[model samples]
Target: MCGIIGIVSHSAVNQELYDGLTVLQHRGQDAAGIVTSDGRHLCLRRKNGLVKEAFRTSSHMRKLKGKMGIGHVRYPTAGSSSQAEAQPFYVNSPYGISLAHNGNLTNSSSLQRELFEQDRRQINTESDSEVLLNIFAQELHHQNSYRVTPDDIFKAVAGVHKRCKGAYAVVAMITRDGIVGFRDPHGIRPLIYGARKTEGGIDYMLASESTSLVTQGYEVVRDIMPGEAIYITHDGEVHTKQCAENPTYNTCLFEYVYFARPDSVIDNVFVHKARMRMGHKLAEKVQNEWKDHDIDVVIPIPDTSRTSALEMAMTLGVSYREGFIKNRYIGRTFIMPGQKQRKKSVRQKLNPIDLEFKGKNVMLVDDSIVRGTTSKEIVQMVRDSGAKKVYFASASPPVRYPNIYGIDMPAANELIAHDRTEGEIAELMGVDRLIYQDLNDLKDSITEGNNELVEFDCSVFNGEYITGENKAYFDELQQKRADSSKKKKNKRAAVDMCNSQ
Candidate 1:
């Protein structure tokens, strides 16, 4: 997943784009980039780091002078985190275009192969964004028009949507025309627009999350509709059209559970509230599973689990305490270099407070366990902190299946819960008791009355693949993951033998 933002303004928009990307820094911390169009040139800057680190200071922002701009903060999904993979990818062939994208394209491998074989277009990096840019460029070239108009841009984007099969939310800036934005047919990723009333007129902005708009002194206009394309011109002319109709809405449920910031509102639902409901629902599961255990304290893994932990604590009538202190210098364990690094990093990332857990029965709440390595480390840390007993509660259900959508998860075999029972998992983690949120409870928590905030693509949790035309492809993907796991194990064994020698 990644973060994308675009703006069409009367004044220079570099600072605005920078501020918006700063607010979206939580969505992606691996890399940051911005491309601004001053009606002539698309000034661009990108690097592998946080937005603050990439730009260094305001002087860097001053270099990009433009009335229209697009920015990106990237978390690698299908690509390596490198300078070449950093986004705001540009193509100046038929017309100068700079684009940033969020979400992964499941059919990108197939599409890239087709492009390479037929058109001989070489893909440089492993980024889906570069593939998207090449696709747009190819479409523009095929049109063979002398002058590119906003309609041409829309048609090109619509064509890409028709050919592509996966989740994507895109923001782009054309050299002369203005800023354009679109969301994939599934609407798996969020894209919201905001407007700022200025002296010249109203400036339009689009961002992956709404909190960025709020930070930039703009009121949220609305979320970009699924299967829709919007174009805003330099003259303040806003045009919108439905590129596709009645697309399946499988907005990522993980956004609420962990990815997005608490303040960000996605698809008209507050993220923090949804997580709290997940906690409340999880509490019900815990109460049913372990009626005899006395829960003295509810402790959250710091940062992401704070709100959900509070809700669980309130529902279970337990005292909540800051049991773990997270090291601010460390990045997220999941985003670290490798599996070995991730396992080691967790120990340095969090430290249990002895005051909160000493001789106490602590119910530890965490968002989710991908591979169980980090969860095991955290449980061990709590035990070492003098806890008499540790009960593990996961806000989301066990992820037995890999997420092909965008989330980076190991294959099914690597998932501790895929083949093991809860009791088995509890023993492995060295916890006294383990409770997982029921799938039904997870669905109900995200839905209110008869209205669901977002339709979930929960293949990872349920093994019920929901892609309409690509059901066979998703089935194949699941099988491929199983096969890949075996290969990885064999490779690791070979490496172990070499080391022994």
Candidate 2:
């Protein structure tokens, strides 16, 4: 998934967009871009680097002067990480629209063919985001009206929801009109909107997380309702309508387990609290599974697992230690786009505190293990740190299937737990024992009492894709990504080896 933000303000919004994107950088970091409209020209800048790196200079920021703007931070789930694939993809139609999207479109491949054959539109990049932008543009163009109204925007989004068959949270700028945002029919991704009245007037903004709003000095209005479309006018008036008919809502479960920042609140639940509940639920199994083994301390894998480790320590009656020192500059290895990058970043991202592991029966907690590449590396690293015995635990269950909604996971065979039992996986990782959260426990932890959210997209573990798309297509998609991941990994390895020399 990616991070998207859009703002409609009376003053220049370049700095605000930059700050919002900085807060969302943890959501994605392979590349970043921002496109702005001064009610006339759409000044755009996108590059294959972090948001700060791309817009680091004063002159670069100066170029993005606009009262309305949209920004994106990207980590490739469908396309490879490249300059052309970075988001805020622009196309000159429907009043010079530029769009940034957060979720994957499962039907994009077939839709691309239809766009070329029927719509006669050429898609340049492999990015599914561009496909989504074109779809909205084509639908808006279908109305064949010179002046577009808020109703036109709603109708266009309705058309998009009717045609598209995957998860998406989109923010689009219609040049002179205002900013419009919508979620897919399934509401598989997240989008939140907020506003603040400055000296000039009310400034309206939308982002992937509520923390962006809080950090940028705005009060959250509420989550943009599932299957809803919002339009912010030039005069700062906000209008919303439910465009999709009878849509099902399922927020991605991984957001609570791993993706979103601890401070962010999504779907009316605090992410940090969900993770703590995850730790508590996981402890139920850990308590009985490891009751016989003498455990000395609970060491979190740093960052994502910190909250869970504390809760798990409290439950298991063990001491909690920040046993791993993480390198802050390195981006999240899990979203690094390729397996090799993730593997290389393990050592580069974290180091063991010798005292915590030296001759101790240490239990390491991680958010989740996807391909097991990093888990293996961390296990080896913990062993190298002189641990008497190492036990492994996952806050979430084993990720056995693919997440077609918006996560990047390798092919079925590439997954470490694809066909292997927990005991087998434990042996493979060289750990004394491995404890995984139960599937039912996972659901209970996220939605035990939360009434606002009814269900979650747990397709990664259950293999029950909510959209009911063909399983064969997902397999092909996974294989293609797996191959690309391997190639990028080998390239990184070669570069690292050369540098060592």
Highest lDDT scorer: 2
Scored against the true structure, residue 346 in model 1 reaches a CA lDDT of 91
Q: Which is the leading candidate under TM-score? A: 2
- Across 117-182, the per-residue lDDT of candidate 2 in tens digits comes to 999999998788989999999999998889788888999999998888878999999888899999
- TM-scores for all candidates: the values are 0.91, 0.95
Please list the C-alpha lDDT of all candidates, in the order they appear. Answer: 0.81, 0.86
Q: Which segments of candidate 2 are over 4 A away from where they belong?
A: 288-290, 335-342, 484-501
lDDT of 1 by residue, 50-103 (tens): 999889987788888888899999876535655777889987776777889998
